[model samples]
Target: MKAVLIIVLIIFTSLSSGKKFRWCTLSDLEQRKCAELSKTLTAVLPVTSIDSFARISCIRAHNTYDCIDKIRVNKADAASLDAGDVYSAVKLYGLTVVAKEIYEQGNCVFAVAVAKRGTLDIQRLRGVRSCHNGARWTSGWNIPLGFLLARNDLSWDEAQPLSQVISEYFNASCIPGVGVAAPQLCALCQGQKSYVRDKNHFCETSSNEPFYDSDGAFRCLKDGVADVAFLDHLAIMEATESEQQEYELLCPDGTTAELSKYNTCNLGKGPGRGIITRHNFQKITNKFLTMIQRLFGRKGKERARFELFNSSSFGGKNLLFRDATQHLQLLEEQLEIAYVLGLDYVALLKGLGHEGSSLDNRVVRWCCISNAELRKCEEWALSVKSDPLVCVQGTSMVNCIEMIKSSEADAVSLDATHVYIAGKCGLVPVAAECYGQVCAPADEITEEMRNLHLKHKGLSPVYAIALAKKNAKQINIHNLRGRRSCHSHLYSPGGWLLLSRYTVGALENVTENCDVGSAYQNYFWKGCMPGADGNLCKVCIGDSEVEGARVSSRCAASHNEHYYGNMGALRCLVGNPSGRSFGDVAFLEHSNLLWNIENLKSSGWAKGYTAVDFELLCPDGTRAAVTEWAGCNLGPIPPSTVMTRPVTVTKIYDFLMKSQEFLGSKLDSEFHLFQSQKYGENDLLFKDATQYLVPATHMSYQEILGEPFFQLAESVFNCTPAAWNHVQQHPPVHITHSTELGSAVLIACNGGFIIFLGSSRVNALD
Candidate 1:
């Protein structure tokens, strides 16, 4: 029985589905034009088969309101409507606007007020007689009224209605469509008879009234009845075409546009009428958009046979679409129906005036280092009151920086290295973390002369140091070839960067094509280098695996990677399986070494390692005791810096300071805030070594890194590990045209030949 009913339903639906696309129309003339256009479309359209293609049919309605209702119920497919009507259709029926009508040179037109030159100014027109197109219309109502509400401090009471306020503001105004309930609103109407729908000759929405539409409102001003005419820019342009010297446009600032340039000389702008359809008919809307553009567009071939844009008989006004429209503009993804018709305009149409919703737009969105970083940021979010802060997480630091630029996230903490890259990519640094508590003020130590030594407690410079076994006498500091090595991570100051600089500079005849990771892998027999992906992770022996990810979380540069960071690298050297490949040397900071030696149980891999078991490798081809790190250190590395866009640098700096005062220290035991042990051997959001965050004295990357170090770092940054392969083979030259290989051309006057060697090289004429 179910199968039989399904077959019957399918057959019924298929039979009911007609071969014509129905478009809703408001008048009889539009229906006639629709029929004529449908017949002409067959010949004009370039479709392969006309019989299979849908034909155009018109569904007539009394007004736009009825047309929208019919379209919503699937009685008709589409209709063109003004922004005001479009807003109603979108709000009530969830309609999607496919395309908008383009007039003059813009997809939108502005509403303007016209008055006799030298007669009156806008500021003094409180008691002047005004002629409006109609109540609740774009040009006549929403535009002028919305602009006034936004700019002026109109002393209106909550008890008084919008119509009453408008009536009181303008002494005698012809605002058509105002009901009889608001008698003061319609007091300016010239018609003597009582309020009637279509019978009244004045202050009515239809053509029966003298000041109804754009033309009529301008006519009221032309005949010397109204002091000012409130209408669309197009209407004023059309009115002044024959009588150019009759009137002038009133500017917002009480000035006048003596010569008409509607683009610049207009009041408030609003989107024009757009073709709307129900949201459910997405496929139909797509097809209809293509067909309509082919039929009625500026370059449309069908428009040559039958004019779809213009209306001819039966009232001779705008029918299916406004006749004055030059072409149809397809809206992009960013623009929506509600957006096209602004919020203020929509509010006015719905009679809900804009009071305070437009104000109080302040939100500080913070970018997190990792998913785990969100926990602390959430706590911070609760603390902030004015300009509330919210947290958003990204996969990596790169992702966070990108999110900030795209407005997905507002700010993120960055290392000094990352600070340089972010600044190059159009981001600015907000504050720098000082090692000590005593900062020499933000401006006092901005220059290089000042030491900027805050002398704060519990903070000191982190130093890059090399570690090796106490009994390891087989490998010398200068000759580290074939010795298993461990690194903190790639690009880290104490690991890849510092080591790469020393090794590459010390090694003889080193070319640019040398892959640093491959070289490190080849240099070491077998060892752990955490956060190394692909070939770089060849020797990394991570114990734990990340849950359900294609990327081995063990090899990740993030906190998820088990064998990651300075401590992880140190553990790789000391805790390698007794018999198997154990790292002979480790590159890490001096502070992490002391911390791990003191608390062996903190890291899973640091079980059996002790301070007496390891020694530091100095550059002078000698190994020294671990306690002598001050003399054996490679270099002093700066602390991690916090950065943000220049727009909110000050706000972010203040927020950071406030947050640190409460939750940045170990005193907040509820959560070990900045301490790495809280997150299990991971410095997720901030470095665990950092005692506190302080304002950066130096601003630029060049300033932070002294002139000597800046020059060296810049040179190294310019050339990647494998840059030799990309080096220019010869001097580059401009080529007129691409030629085949081995092709040669003889010069016209000279006995020289220009030869094409390949795609890149060309032998020029001599």
Candidate 2:
């Protein structure tokens, strides 16, 4: 009887104690609010029968991180954390999100850079005074700074603190909580700094600091203490009408937009605060939160007595949850923290020194074409230590694309034309090469500028020009019929597609069902359109002479042919070493035009020709200096892009961005990433004129190619019966088919064919 009585008493004690859910509180005000919440919940429990409704108890912690630790150790059941802290909590503490704080804008918020209208240029933010909500905060520090780091506007050596990098990037900043780690960043702060030790509140992450949060940061900008303010979109939305009218958002693309357009014109978007609990404790915590929110949420039955989201009575902003939060949304699905925070946002945070889970240890297999590119790839493989790269050689660029699509290779850099074909093959662009002025100025390039260039280089537009010798007076855009031409390669955007759009398409009125290759073959009497057969190869001067003195590599699509890329096309127009000109006009990208001329001159191919000797054939039947390509060109072209499978896009981008940091410098003596002279070739692996590789993970092939250029590509690839017959006869290495109506059919006369039919899509892999 005594043993049974003792066992019953112990059982009752355990049940009652375990039924109490402890809530983590970071400050006194939060603890007070949590106590009130506990009382209100207990008061409402008598009216309901929720089995998981445990009596609430407040557990005090030092800070958010402490709260995370306390909850992880099971001392506390749950706590609300910002997106950044949520990443840390889930990543480091192995906690799980049970519910999210839903604001009026849903579960995510936009981080925006705001400056006085017409007062600042988004691209040139270096050395400017800036305001941030607080150190390590999401919209204030992490998002904005991470954006700069991701774009290459700020360079960081992972060994050093990120605060140091920010201090050097900006002249002064009002970043609360930076403290003494970076005093200079707090130079523009309005926090108290009295001689009395306790009175000093400079850069404190509290109300004591004048510029402590989003509202304070905005005030700093308005007071003219800071040139720009980095804060969440809600703060901007809450600003007075006149204040909104006085400022505009600085978009990451180097453009400015009105305040109302924050959705598209912000640094980046990220998840909102979420309620997290110990990994397996989500079931009970979720039910507990659901019950409390039901009674105190936006439309709670007892909201008039005690509001869950509102913190005014607690004497703090966003105490238990953001005051802006409307309700708590239960997240029932098991989700990876990265999925909740977003991959881009996670990448940004990872770049900003918030280390997360380890990166995949798999090596990236880079696809290479030709012996020269293989050698360069081999050397590059040895250069990068973090992301190991291995070389996989293919017979040609198209073959490389096939290899990548078949999982035999991981990545390859291709011109705009090939990028389109790759996209059709289910590959995506991870990065793009920026040439000339679009990149950071080589002479004045700083780490910050390099980073900025890496971020915005994809937006840089390329131009196509119709190049003809100054002596060819009759070779204007109008009288080019039957003239010998030198094209970069078949299906090349600037050389073939844009040229055909202006010349053949315009003259023949071939809107639909057009055979662009046949049209070019018939239009040009004799020409070297690399990758094409018959008459197109007649004018080609191959790499060298064979035993019978026959041109060995005539009209080949790669650098093995003497007349292949933009430089090679220029070489064709400049004539052979014996001064035997092969063509009257050349079509190619305007990038490095002057450099190509000088290179040829130095190589003795154009012994006495100067840049002035070349002229641009204007579309209006006029001729202008080559430098006037802006006013006299075929059309704007997109830059070259690095292609990879969708699953490997982020992995490839991370590798390339790191590679650029280590090897992109022209000053790097071991192996210059952009120079190919040592390989005895031009544009191997990547374009020789490339200044740097920019991240293109967020872009699609259409976005990278731009709407106009993409449309032009579509028109060029809309094959007619003749073109289809030509493709069948050539019988390329592989054939890809798409079922969707109006899908593009990209054909490479010498390499492969992509046919779109009104049937199921198929990949005819060899």
Candidate 3:
């Protein structure tokens, strides 16, 4: 009975031991760090009723991969890994990233090529002798090779092994990982073959090889045995610290620069290392999160007791984390591993030598402004994540446009006013929203809209009109010098151009200082003209601001701003009280009037207001019904255009065209490509009245607004005629199915309707 009772007692103790959190340790250094960390954690954690603090036990493993396997099978709860190793654990073993390692430089490190000054130029790297850290590693291999493959300078056979292709491309190399696959891979390795000090080593991927780690690769170059050493920026920094005069970094732009400028002159970039754990240990991972932070974080309070990140105890580098890591960041639940590393890096790893998923390579990264728009974009991203769609958030449309120019984002849907700015920044219109019907076949075309191309419906050449109460006849067209007025924006054709020009000419104040824009600011006591000079925005209430400014003019520069665009001007007129920054009349597009008037209750302003309360102020000093805008409206304006960097027009066009085919008007889709429902605003992303999207071949600023109209806009915006002339002469080229690679096939839609279509739609064109 005593023997049986002792057996039961041993089983009970083992079951109780399971309550303790188990952390995987790969090396003696990691085991020692964990031992020190556990003691500190015991003191910090809350004690239980049994007087025992949160307990931690070490789980031993031979390598990081073994530790990941141990976690997967529940032998261990967690382990830290390099990004490349994290990718493997997440992809192959169902591991989850709990935290990311943020180094002093940041979460990302640049991969660069370093050589003796004047030894090699970036352009002719072909057949050059090379030194690489290892095969399939992020910084040393994937980044450098992916950069080469993208430029089409390095060609290889996908059917053959990756090692064979790499060997053939380089005249000689000391790449460390390939000795197992093929000995020729280490043909240039200078390590002693019989070094018995290390077992199963020499020209290997680990520290066993003399030319394996980043330091080893640089040593190859330092000894004058290799022409170029491809390694991470951190490695180069560490290796060349003592001998700075002999080495220089290579830039992708065919030049050599200082090693300190590696971020700007590198092959590519990759994410930092991270701590990975199995999904089942989420609770344990969460528990350890705070404990680990207190013990080893950048500002860890318990770091004095033990250095968790030290990687130099053994003759090798990299313990639980890279030695260079500054701290570990707790990752949010929604942040995916691939997303943290960036999709491009993951895609390269998916298929090193062969053509991987085209969808991966052709992801369309979009930029949006405002949290509301970002929410909508996130929804859109979910639908097209298979297309590898990604979204970047910006503060304003101007910021989005800048993102595209810097290659930080792929595209953004822009307003006509923004299109002009984007064009000046070297962007081209790919497709446009079509508002009017395509027009029945030639036989069915009507005489009133004979020209199908002129069927703008409610888009460009759109009439701009002044709306005011009928009783406001006291404000005649010619005698409104001191009247308060509302305008769409400072630079919009409808708000600033037509009305300002007419009012200035009427008042005979059209000189340089008293230009149309300034004259209106002086004439109107106070108006809600967005983007207008200072006091003009006194009546404005928008919160968003330009980069250096304190506050955004009350007019909306983006969806985030209130009363910013044509609709904003209408809101300014109807929402604000008259004479207190509100206006007796509003200068805006005719469509904004029609759209908002029908949905006033939805607009949250002018409740109980009706069309009978407003009338059009014609230039001829006569009042007319709002419906009579055709007769009373100002000069026509061009339709809104979708613009992108000239280099990416073709790719963006192809993706958009494909998207529309499945989610286009013909398909029954869950999401509307050109719709939003925030505050009952129908035209958030694209215009609500859109009919289709069309190509905009040979479209120019001058074409959108005829030369005379363009000149007027230039004057309003204070643009030089020479510069304006240049914008007109070189019309933006649109990429099309038939257009050659070097040329453009500009596509346009009417009324700013964002059409969801693709190359399939191109064939649908008559």
Query: Local error of candidate 1 at 378, Å?
Result: 4.4
The 10-residue segment of model 3 with minimum total lDDT is 738-747
Instruction: List, residue by residue over 1-766, the lDDT tens digit for candidate 2.
Output: 3443343233333334335788887556788898898777566543333233345778876556667889988888888877777877887678898777776656667788999999887788999999998777778877677566544566665456768888998999988767688888889887678877556667766556777777788889999999999988777776778987899999877889898888778875556678899877777676667656666888777788899888888787777788898877776557665445443345445545566324332568898866678888888888887668989887667777767655567789988888877776556778888776667644445646645654554346678889999987878887788999999987788777788766677325653336667677778888888888888888888776322333656777777677888888988887778878579999998877887888886776768888889899988889999888889988887888898755455557778877877674436458878778787667888887777776676566888787777776665554444455444433333543311111101111111123421112322222
Best by TM-score: 2
lDDT of each: 0.58, 0.71, 0.61
Better of 2 and 3 by lDDT: 2
Worst 10 residues of 1 by lDDT: 741-750
lDDT measured at residue 76 in model 2 versus the true structure, 0 to 100: 89
lDDT of candidate model 3 versus the reference: 0.61
Off by over 4 Å in 1: 1-366, 369-391, 436-460, 506-510, 513-522, 542-545, 549-551, 576-582, 602-604, 664-669, 724-766
lDDT of 3 by residue, 412-456 (tens): 766566676566444566666655444233233343443346434
Query: For candidate 3, what's the RMSD?
Result: 16.4
TM for candidate 3 is 0.48
Which has the better lDDT: candidate 1, or candidate 2? Answer: 2
For model 1, name the residue pairs that clash: 432-696, 436-456, 437-456, 438-454
Instruction: Give the Å shift of residue 714 in candidate 2.
Output: 11
lDDT of 1: 0.58
